[model samples]
Target: MGGGADDADCGDAENKLGCILSYNSHVELCVVNYTMLAVSLVAAGGLLEAERRLDPSRFGRKFVWQAAAFMAVAAFQITLCFVVNCSGVSIIWNAVVAFNSITVPGDTPRHFLFMYLLAFAMALSLDVYYAFTLELLTTIAHLCSLLLGGLGGFMYLRAFPNYGRQLRRPLLGAWNGDGGGGADDDEDDGSTNSSTGSV
Candidate 1:
């Protein structure tokens, strides 16, 4: 964890290796230092599982878009963080966390909403504080990661809301479904399950 808080050359041996390895020392704290690759794998798995639970069918088709979005976020954050703070930034886990903690179906229960907001607040606080404290680039990178995730999630729902499954809610509570949030999964997750019940 030799990656300093504000290294002049984040690419220097002491920082570059650490940056790429952990993306930044403050990231998973101690978890990423020794196992960055493992962490990335786990993040991706978690994202996929969460998506699977949203709609149990046609996971194969959806995988293409999900995978593309994941790679795009990771690459963008990594490049931006390294350039701005000489800090390596890995958005894989961050994006996954953001999407899961924030995406919820309507009628998802009030308790679930509370927990999601709590998690999001904590994450937002950290990013905002870092940005205010002179790590603006860090905040930017992190924000991009979150936005990309949220956007991709909405798109996913709009495209494939599943023809017969009962989706919890619309994207952000009012977008897809009769309101299509989930079919091509790109388009029926919101018309009220009085649906055709097609399999």
Candidate 2:
């Protein structure tokens, strides 16, 4: 009756993520959806920050690169939702599983379970906070991240050369070189010559 795998707490799903949704083989559960949404959000902010540092021009460059990065991440997320098809095998959802494994359900190292619950609570709290703050713009941004993340995973199968090549070509062609949509050619010209004209 002490610290065994068959303890009642060990058998409870609530001891894990407490997921409620179940679709089918597609997404099939709340765990995958929750993790994908979280991942897409994080990836979007990282992309925007990277672009801002690399090309700090504020005029309109921010708009173009920011948009593409969000869209690409979105596409990847969406494809992940539908195509991944099973949360049981999902890398994202299994993060919870792995964390939960830190404490055997019926074992004495109960602090790990406390840590997991604390982390989950904090994540859910932030989700609620952001949900209340979201508006039309951010909502669309979320949807686009879903679509782009999905597309990226899809293209991973086909092995595309660039991230969101199609999105960047049309949206950002005017801002960069490679002759208006470098869809067909490698983006580098490898020239070191520089000249300036003064009047």
Candidate 3:
């Protein structure tokens, strides 16, 4: 009986350790992912401003420096993932594919709505930056930064719920009944049962 209890205790300890490790891994991955995203966005913004102004100096020397910094951070993130032997390539490739696949089919209403909202936000940000800075060139640079930041934020929010759901559902299931039990109960009851049974 004592041996059995010891074995059970060991098993519990192992499980808890695994859970803690998994949680830490997820937190690390999220930080790396966002850091890379920010780096890419900043680099892209710098390039956009350089092109728009057609003058490297107008965007300022610091813009180029910032672009390099962002890329270095992104590289660090990639290296860390590779070192950890995590499935980083799959995540990166899937994200690229999904981004590329987002398109409007025959100019649908939703497509127009998305376009309008995006354009309005871009214009608004530009206007605000210009109004406050009173420098047309610097305003353009800032506007690009705002757009990139907004895109990163949007992607983070979209991915977060799915990630959180995956992480929590298993533990939640063990504590409560299976998470899908309510749905299963509803199905078992039959959606059409009330009207059809009596008739």
> Of the candidates shown, which would achieve the greatest lDDT relative to the real structure?
1
Q: Please write out the lDDT profile of model 2 over residues 99-129, one tens digit for every residue.
A: 2222112211223334444444544453344
Each candidate: RMSD to true structure?
A: 7.5, 18.7, 25.2
> Scored by CA lDDT, what does every candidate get?
0.50, 0.33, 0.34
lDDT of 1: 0.50
TM-score versus the correct structure, for each prediction: 0.54, 0.25, 0.22
What lDDT does model 3 reach? Answer: 0.34
Q: For residues 1-199, what per-residue lDDT tens digits would candidate 1 score against the true structure?
A: 1122553335554556455545344554434322433443444454455455555576677677767777776676556545644544435555655655444444233334444545455455555555666445555666676777777667766777552243444445523223233342433433433376533
In what order do the candidates fall by TM-score, top score first? 1, 2, 3
Worst 10 residues of 1 by lDDT: 174-183
lDDT for position 46 in model 3: 33
Candidate 3 lDDT over residue span 81-177, tens digit each: 3443222221222222222122111112232324433443443543454357443433443344444444543553353332222222233242344
Candidate 1 positional error at 65, Å: 3.5
Could you tell me the lDDT of residue 142 within candidate 2? 38
